[model samples]
Target: MFDSVLVAVFTYNEENKISEVLEKMCKKFKNILVVDNNSQDNTLKRISNYPVKCIHHKYNLGKSNSMKTALDYARINNFEYLAFIDGDGQHSISDLEKICNKILDIKNGLVIGFREDLTNLNLKKRIGTKILNKIFTLLYKKKISDIQCGLRVFNISEKSIKWESSGLQHYFADAEITCNAIKNGCQISQIPIQTITSDKFKGMNILQGLYLLIMIVVWRVF
Candidate 1:
């Protein structure tokens, strides 16, 4: 069991998938947390069935806020590492396990489970990622294949990689973390993982992609 590691699952109306995710995670991990964004569905009730700590919001905070809440919980509870996995069934639990195992061997760093293939994703998602990848390479001088993958693990004690992404950039939080870590000269490792793509697992749209492109430059300079 990962005694010092906290696995946080963020959910919103994920009733259909939450129970399964919690069931698997609970069996594998001792310390698990679920941050629900006032899900109107049975997501909250589904989480209650598992033997994990849960925080239900009064209103629907964005996905990014749930991330902040999870990070705060990890910090307050003194967890050495925090791992994020979506409540939706898109992320691979095996990949998350790989990240946790990898982080344990690192002194301090961020571990991201980059998707191994993108042929099944939407065209916009593919194009958007390519543009962002180009800019990220130019600005950060690092070649990361997937900048917005949510299946990630990082040391909670390392403040340099703490991100300040807000608003609709909820989808861009992972990207911000990568850029911040690179700028601060922190260790970052990307492990290839399989992803299940679907409409429910929405990647950023045109506007969010454009905003993130601009913010990547802002984060690099200021």
Candidate 2:
């Protein structure tokens, strides 16, 4: 699977945890790609010695753009699967094997790692996530446990399915991708995953949520 799959880690100022995360990933997968969004810290320097490919953005693009970069790379390189993990040390490396195994089993479905615990998040975030989840279910006709989960595995071989909002700066680009895939007749499934809570996990603000709501409605209608 390592030969056919590419593990992409998206990072932005994860100096404290990038080294350990990259080390763990390198140990498991031979082809690892780190898409860095111009980290202000020593994240790039820290991962410089690792046996992985690094793509540094000239500016600080958002997570969605970073994902598109990795997706394009994986597709061009002819990788059958693309696994995404965050570099903030929240997503567990132990779950990668399970995710990869699930991807192998599903073959062509979008496998998302569902984070079961929302107790660590604030009331606003939890409520917002719940509302967003409902909206996703209504729009995509698929029940998504965690639409914003950063840990996911995608089968890049489905070239016909394209991500509509890949260029969007909104946090809901993950939702957009999932919805697009589902609308394009792709099966979606979720696997329970363990996440390390952090204060840095502040999700979209009220304005962003409102914007995402508009995006969802527009996508639904059209």
Each model's C-alpha lDDT? Answer: 0.85, 0.82
Candidate 2, superposed: residue stretches over 4 Å from native: 164-168
List runs of model 1 lying over 4 Å from the truth.
Answer: 199-201
Query: How much is the lDDT of residue 80 in candidate 2?
Result: 92
TM-score of each: 0.95, 0.92
Compared with the true structure, the alpha-carbon lDDT of candidate 2 equals: 0.82
Worst 10-residue lDDT window for candidate 2 reads 160-169
Leading candidate by TM-score: 1
Candidate 1 structure quality by residue, lDDT tens digits, 145-173: 78778898999888786777766677778
Poorest 10 consecutive residues by lDDT, candidate 1: 195-204
Clashes per model (N, Cα, C within 3 A):
0, 0
TM-score, candidate number 2: 0.92
Summarize candidate 2's per-residue lDDT along 115-140 as a digit string, tens digits.
Answer: 78878777888888889889878877
